[model samples]
Target: MASGLGRGNGAAAASVQLGLWTGDAIADRFWKFYGEETSTRAITRLQFLEHVGYLLFLKLDHERAQRAGRFAQQPVAPVDAWPNLALLSGDALHTGLTTLFDELGDQQLSDRPDRQTASVVFRDAQPWDLDRMAELNKLIVEQIDPYRWLAVPQAELGRAFSRMLRDCRKEIDSKIETGQTLTPLPVLNAITKVLGVGPEDIVIDPACGTGTTLIAAYHAMLAANRQLPPAALAGADLDAQMCRLAMLNILLHTGRPFADPAPVRLADTLKRKTPVVRSGSGAVPTVAICNPPFKSNGVQPDATMRDDFWAYGDFPTNFLQHLAITLPQGARAAVFVPDGVLSGGGAAATVRQNLLRNCDVHTLLRLPTGLFHRKGVKSNVLFFTKSTPKPSGEPATRHLWVYDARTGNHHTDTGNPVTEADFDDFVASCLPEEGFAARTESKRFRRYSVAEILASPKTSLLLKAHLTKELGDFGSPKEIAFEVADRLDEAAAHFRQVAEALPGQ
Candidate 1:
């Protein structure tokens, strides 16, 4: 697991913190500095993030080389060798940074296959205004020490980056698009626990946002087997900034070098010929975990059409179909989908029917509303496995288990983040670790036959739990407020769609 860190660092280094500036604290300090920069300078949040990403990359690489004693015998160092050179003022710092970016670009092209990846990350990346860039470097070196970054565990560092990204977007306003949102970590943990990822399993997230889902899967794999299997992780994102963040996140989490090609790349997963493939084995992904963008428009008209486009439903359903068709038989998937995918009519219903015919749609988990950065957004997690077709051409799914974790579970983004405790009953009842134990059903958890599920109008999978009087079969005023907020959000979304569809919008 500590393969990338040099001699004195490993499992022992996981808990090491330098003086008072811990890893989490360092990330917080960076975020605070980011706010100051964005507020004072003329730079946007996106531009500042790009600047910081480059600086952090350089600092981390320098720390790694020092720990490994790479320059012990060298007579003279390269221009980029001394990260401390960033502390200089005016012309010296400017010259040092210009040459540093140049040397880094040249080194990235040192390999053949990695050139394009380098171009994607380093394209248009040059030094910003001297004063602003110098301030950022000073923050990294003086406040957040270079060696402190290497002292903490890689997973925590990766998570720190994720949190910082989330905070930057949430607290500060910017022109950045709202297409990507990081999945909450507790929710991610619950999904990975249900999937039970192992060392040998190749996990892929086609819509990876900052590589959160992939990192969670990596940690799950490490827990299953005490080894680092970075090559088994793969992801892709359409947004270039998101791809950059995912690359940095993966590098930090896996302790891989900046030069190595991350499992993640920049591409539209739906448009790519092969959406998901293991970088290590070149085999089909054994496990898929996705949280696709919500309510995105269908593919462009110029793009080639395929049957699995599935009635031109939203991206979530299309991504679900992509998994249903592309994954090999017996491969498993756990996808975070909106309530519309489970309950909406027309295209969504058809996709659900086709999914049942092709895959064993086993579990439906109704997640709490406002569980993401975006409020009033209700979502669900569908757990399923690809199955071989039956001789008699019957549907693959037999019994469907639905867990209603949403009703009366008024979890907001700030007030109550979803936690492992929230998933205890749901996990123990259906998703046990070892073997197939008998699952005891409760009021919130129920089992339904496929025929009964299909009998519902439009074959909707949004089944409500039958809570008894003892279980408090009622909604409080807070629940009513949440419902109202959700309805208002839906109405606002509908208006936005209408406005967008109008001429000259």
Candidate 2:
């Protein structure tokens, strides 16, 4: 837990002990207005909650500005600062929000902006009906207070608050077949560290889901003492709802809706052009970090791409390939990919070959099963950089390091939560001063020359692919048979999904 934050009490469950919330408690808050309602009601209410939260945060922020002239000369940061909104009547809040909404689009106010200025973002915007306005005000009053919300991270707080309004699984499933699962915090920390992102870099998450990766990157930049605005980081997703959520997620988490807006493009990154950013370099960047939709199966085509990713494979393979080929020279990337992308014939091999021959393919951290909400998802994070193109016939990956953190690092229950500590060694090893070149071998971490990788059957990059397994050695015959059956079932599900998406089924 973050210091000073309280964990939920088991003995005092009946008592009103505010501020302490267990993981299940948090999840319950998310499940609130979401699961049962009709789609329209669910999403609208959820969007309303986000709007109200943004307004509430701004109200608190403006209070700091008001108090600066009285007791403090400088504005206060939001870390522990609290401004009581419980006192604001429903009418007063409705009026205050209405006024701010007008100013957000006002040309005169644009000439001389203030911190409390409005932010008009795209996606499911707030509704102006009186019933919703009244409901939003009451919900805010009943659920929010200094005691309960002062320490909550905005993204987490936003999700919890919105849950009371809607989960809208149907609305979500229409966009993503897989349940929307966040990139676990441990995975987020490790990937952020490995990318070596600094203040000077322009970052992007091509498949930013609710903007978790982008928001995490924002905090990382702040930790690095970078004054970069929210616009420095960008995200793109095929879902319009997510685009809007990404915009709101960034705003609420950073407490800076007024920061110059970054483009959260609502385009399939694999198939369409990203929105133009103000950076004058269009949409490509210094660092591309993504846990893209692992299941996008569209037979998408692109003639303009400098490389033929389709000739290489399918939805996610091409998505990863797009990021690899389009990343500006010298830019860095950390991508979460399925095990299939590492090896296999046809397009997968082609894409792997291009990555090895061109990009300096460096680290491959093969993730464990059960790391995601999607059980049996065997994933990996491929960390590489797009530097100058390699010479003809020269492989860009001279030597590649692989880290296996899967076999023994299993999370079978909630109490034994996985965390960033589990990946400490891998994070430290990725340091620029002691990267793959300085790394040595271990049972969990190993290295292979480019020749070794290409010489492996089918250019398979998975380091443990060749490690032979002894059958029925650890368990009784019946137990071993069950285990083999389980493995087959998991593989069947993965391949079946792929087959369902093929052109002819």
Candidate 3:
């Protein structure tokens, strides 16, 4: 909590006392304002949000610098200096914003990686066009006050910015490519719990969107009393705007200087020569967590990629293979993947077989449906540890535990969102502190040997322990559609297996 912000009383559950507004509330105002004000020559909702983020970033930094007595040396940082909005208006305000952004790009962020991301955030940012600058001024006055930015602590502001990211994503969700999805915080927590991130471990996300996964890992590290430097976390994403957002997100969470080089890089993870690095004082990544793109058509066949990366012919499998091969031995990873990667025949089967052979593939949790941004997409989290070379050439994995959280459960984006408690039973079943023998099976949890897994059709890892069928309450239309799609996927996998068993091609 900030010094001035107040909490609501018992009766007013959704109320914020002392006029402290939430990030969701601020985003709603921005979107509504954009719809009513923006015209043909104006910016899109995405561009408007980026501009707002820039202003917010500057305002937050100004306050931080002022408190530290370092504000005197910076170039015209004028956001918080104004006592109120009445002093600036119209063309003058627009020109001032343009100059500030220009100076920010040219002077402050002109270095290597920072310049790259700043170029994206401030690219062609013509604030004078079609009343956008005026709109921004109006929003700052009415919704997000500069005084509020100064008053809130960095943690609260970071939380607000995170919530704003989630809210704003819903507005621009259609603009991004298919298979790009945002992970809800609770889902991120569940994945991190399985990894059990420690103080000394370095964490990375290959497909880091908005840096939420890395933020979750940061918080987990903080819980263990870790002294988190900016170099403790690293990530990469193909989208430049996403890289910018991730940089801002991590900066806000870590309380790093505003001009530090982004921990995330704007490079295609599949093409990067070295996937993992031990940067300045940062060690080799010991834990990796990601929700990779499940159905990306953008990943085309390229000669630059290694042959093993193309084993399953999809981004999800490629990412899995990337982590399996790139992460140092004894590193742990938890990846969210679609069901096809688990049950598909041919290349998918070969990939699963090799994964089990090369890594200690330990736990498979069949996640509930409707957990992702895509409608009706079924998914799961695969946990494993990279192993060292075996002199005898035996498989690395021994026993695989499967937890079926999808059978009798459902989740939704709005109506019934996923909570961390929803994963409690599954997390307990993982037995993070206990060794393998202490684990016990339940209705939704069971263990299978490597031999049994290999003998299954298509070498499928989509094993489920829950045998009880769903009761009479057929869920919402989305749930029904998800069930249908899941069944179709299962049928397709089985058909592929049957076809492979035929005498001739």
Candidate 4:
């Protein structure tokens, strides 16, 4: 009879599975209730969903706690109401979770004989367990569809999501104070699009912040496996915490344990004693990508760093040089550096000139500001390849192509961000044949001959001044004549006044 009822109520069962109670879905129901009860108005869709998810997680956690206490024969303490957990104000859930972990340590279970037995008291007691944390983070990421919510203006929502991520990190840190990771989605997408990875290529990200670049490279290699096999991906970071996170992220996303148990290392790349080649075969990476920390100086040159063929001592410049040295001959690289590196004087200028002469310095993608989490610091991607030294008197580079996507491109933090579509024209302009055809007649993209670049005072690749010249005159002939006439009239009046004063005397 029960089986028959289940078969008959398939639609009802499906609705329950979908988290729908009667007419409205969970998200809609929460928003409707808030609209009816709350005094405040104008809540965004993302905010409403975030509020609902927080409330649901809290209730679920409480129920789980109650069940665990009953099963373990423990005294029931007063339940913490956690009323403000659903507020979506600021890091409330993160703070609450931290506090819960602290309080849980005090609870004693009669069923547990020893410390190890008591350790598994609650479902989340061992939250820092890598597998468990990854599962929880995956659940949270699934609930919060980041791609869909990317367009949402609710920074409150972003804060809530970031807080959850921080809590995940905190849990991991509590157990094994090392190996935390972060993969910024935008950067990952950019790399996969720009450099299609193959099995032959050994990819590396030296400043592998949370292993995002390495993981992304791995995925890209997998995606391109139809034509080529997967490439070996490796990374190193200065922060041990970041290395941990990178390992965890890689394990979670790839479902494959790192081939080397110590896939990540905690060592400053700029300092001496840094290893140029991997152990054993002395294999160098064929492809590299990174957004290295931009520092003017204070980078101490260590023995290993000193031996770096690309070393010039400037922090970002040194990183650029290090990448050049570590990469195989004729290997391609894409690195992000500050605007100052492109046109700065002294060592920076020398490095830039050397890079152009030694490598096939092909493309420069001028990025807009605020694309990074950091503010105000403008950046660009220098895509070049290390090549064999050209014969004397022959130009290493014949034509330098500049893509001016920076000008007229503006995006606010709370509004729309620069997307792939925004870079379509710039990408088109980069093609060898299309050249200027893909670009607009603005101070954005202009080609420079090898001779022209050599003739420049600093041999700088600063495209703005050159681009402005390409833009031609902004003032019309009539506008120029009117300005000249006005200046002449003023001078003539002053001369007449001077002559009158002298004659009268």
Candidate 5:
């Protein structure tokens, strides 16, 4: 048992490394600065990077001004001089650094000042180079915000770094203006394994934040020798900021091939009666994947226009329902939803029932609390496929297999986070027949028939309830009953003997 438990722990650690490290590869790169004692003094990776990047820009500007003596032409203003520089405006500084880093071929500054400083100098000056400084300033304000380093709390440094890296892609794109390029490493690794997401598969992320999913999908398709079909990928977000970020993310990652009308649109999918189809072309997506916001309360829509909103009195529940409706028949979807959606009463329950009846829910990967920016909210990934009406005799779903990865798990919010390697065993467990047998214990994961699920009150498919069951160690009922009778008879005789002795006296 101890050996088995140790093996499970090892597998889980690997999954965490795979998933978290891959997703935050860029942030992870910046976080290496903390290796220097000076970097650790700051509250966050964002703060450290911003302060360092700002200092570098200042030093670089001063050097440039010194080289071009007073007798020389007027020195150009430092790109960081703009008021928005302090505000961490768009991706200018980040993109510039990314370009600088790429040119330098290293992430660190040199120990020797001259050699290190020379890496950032522009050897070839163009007639329009001064205007490029202005463009850099605009990119900083429009693409990335340095202020985010200060705005994020110390406890949420990991999330801050993730957000910063995601935003930095925009800064890179504002200068270059291209197709989706930067892909979140972790998500890309996961999507690359999907057999169905080739060039032929129509992939979409309705809530494609930063276009991470779409970019990953695009790369995965390319690797498969499938040419990216026109309109093959699409994304949408309720927040215009997210839509813009997604567009920039795609462009920066893909190296801005052409002016593709933003594959992203700003639309509230939940309340809107009509799906926001992109450009009146392209088939409905065969695959959809997203980590939708988990808000449960009444959060107002980004726009007052009610056309695309899903009108449930509650917020997140409406989004879940909306995702279900938008997925075309025979399509497959992997969505991250809060645990409340699985068990919440009233409207949420209705939605769950409708989904189970209409869709073939194959698996539920239960994620632990504190795995997200907003900690302590339980979440699950529901993998399901939409299908046409089947004959009455055919079974719609025979069993719902659940992998409980959240059990006995702990993760620090820093560089060390849960990753795909941590989920390797869980993923392995998901393999059709082989995974089912490799379970260290049946309690960790088990299957339930559809009839058993429907028989439960509220038809709640609570995986935890099914996975944990305690058994008594006592003998069988008949053996226990005989033993109890013998003890009772002995007690009665002892009482009778005491009474008889008292009467005779």
Candidate 6:
């Protein structure tokens, strides 16, 4: 565990002063920021999030400036951004932002070789609000009360900004043709707990949308007092804007120590043959957790991995198989894949079989619907360990535990959002260090032998026998007696048959 987390000068306590409606207010303000042009929610949200993400970085930079004050004498440092933010108006907002954006181009300390390229590369890679900074200032006043609401601690601002953007993601579900759902904070934390992520351990999220998994991992290590540098984290995204926001998110959470290379890279995991992460301690993902895009252009589940070529297929399935195959031997991963990956036929079935044969398949927690932006889509987290070469007949996996959190529990993006507390039992049961060997079947959690999974024609991971959908929780006395009697009678008959068939008899 890392030490001295949450001890930063600008770090806020558990209780932040932001209003309950602050996230909603930010959402409402963004909609208003774009007048009555009435574009698709997807585009509108991208524009809004782009500006807001930059704003978060700007706020942190301003706080850094304040901390660097020089006795209010000998003229303030040339890079102070807070002084202007206080009296920010149209031109002031633009000037402050422009100066900040321009400063990001400095390659004085960049790790890249090309000094000029490193300076402007970050800005030039993504779409900009530089030309429209003045327009955003009007939106800030007409919508976000920048002076009043933006004065919170840098950490709080980042959390609030992230929450608002996730809320907006719910509205863009219909407009988006691709899959890029945000992982709920509680779920992300629970995953970290299950993985037992350490400070020195290398972590990667290949399908890192806005980098929530990586962000959560960062905080987890921080909370554990495990002080990890940006080198310990890596993430990649197909979208440029997502990569940019993820970069900002890492910058915000690792506050005060803002002098490191951004670990996020912009790349499509499926399209790239090589690694998506360009610079880290290494390209290997020791502990991988990703909610990769689930669909392949709204097409069928035809992703393939034969003869060194695959034109198209289920994206999530391909990513999962890729993670399992590419991860270093003995590496473990927790993948968020749709339920189809569990029982779907054709290439999916082959991949599932391969995963089972090679990996030490541990647990499968069926996630509830409404947990993602995709409505009515059931998902599951596959926890497995990659093992080395073994005998042909012997399988790496033996007993498998399946936790059915989705059956009775329910969650939503809003209203009743899932939190870390919601995953208490699931986390306890799924963790291998927490007496995993002594685990037994609970009401919502059950243990299945690997034989049972292999016996299934589809290699289906569904394990809902004890679920409410199967048997009544509180059966009548007669029903209980009958069930017990049936078990005893069957056992007795089997024993009698075996006894009669003995050679002596």
Candidates in order have lDDT scores of 0.68, 0.59, 0.69, 0.50, 0.50, 0.63
Worst lDDT run of 10 residues, candidate 3, spans 6-15
Score every model by TM-score: 0.81, 0.68, 0.80, 0.55, 0.56, 0.71
Off by over 4 Å in 5: 1-195, 273-276, 299-313, 391-395, 412-415, 432-443, 465-505
Task: For each of the candidates, give the backbone clash count.
Answer: 0, 4, 0, 10, 52, 7
How well is each residue in 1-505 modelled by candidate 1, as lDDT tens digits? Answer: 3323222212233332343344476577666776664444566656666666666666566555555456322111242455446456566777776766665544344444434334445545677677665565565554444344665666667666666666665532121233466677778888887777888898889888778898888888888687655468888877767777777777766766554555776667776445463344455688999998775553441246454455557788878888887888888899988888988888789989888888998888888766765434578999999999999988999988888888777665566777789888887877655554466578888888888978889988887664743233224465566446645665787788889999993
Error of 4 at 12 (Å): 20
Tens digit of per-residue lDDT, candidate 2, span 1-505: 2334321111222333334454335546434523433243534544544555464554445443444346432332232232433444466655655554444434343344332223324233443454445555554544443222334555555455334322432244234343244666677777877887777677888778677787767767777764675556887766655665666666655655343444465565666443222334344478888886665344455667434453546655776778777777888888888888887678888788888887898889877655654234467899888867656768877888888777655542133557778888777766636544577676667778999888988899867521434121223343345346645654777799789989983
Best by the lDDT measure: 3
lDDT of 5 by residue, 12-87 (tens): 3111222323325435544543443332332343334443343333332333333335622222233333332333
Candidate 4 lDDT by residue in tens digits, 246-294: 5444433443312222344446665633323233434556788876765
Candidate 6, residue 308: CA error in Å? 6.7
A best-first ranking of the candidates according to their lDDT comes to 3, 1, 6, 2, 5, 4
lDDT of 6 by residue, 1-505 (tens): 2111221223332232345335444455555555553234434565666666655444444444444456222111134454455356555666765665555545454443322212322454333345554556654443332343324444555575576557567543433445666788888888888888877667888878787898788777777664565567888876665676677666555542333455776666655443355553554667888888765343332235233223234777887876777678867689998878888887788888788888898888887656764344567899988897586766788888888777666566765678777789898776645477877778878888889898998888766734567422323354355345544654676688779999993
Any runs in candidate 6 off by more than 4 Å, and if so which?
A: 1-46, 62-135, 138-154, 171-175, 256-259, 272-275, 298-312, 432-434, 465-467, 470-505
TM-score of 2: 0.68
CA RMSD of each candidate after superposition = 5.8, 8.8, 7.7, 16.4, 21.1, 14.8
Which consecutive 10 residues in model 5 have the weakest lDDT in total?
1-10
**Candidate 1 vs 5: which has more lDDT:** 1
Better of 5 and 6 by lDDT: 6
Misplaced by over 4 Å in model 1 are 1-21, 32-50, 66-88, 91-120, 123-127, 144-148, 169-178, 277-281, 298-308, 432-434, 468-505
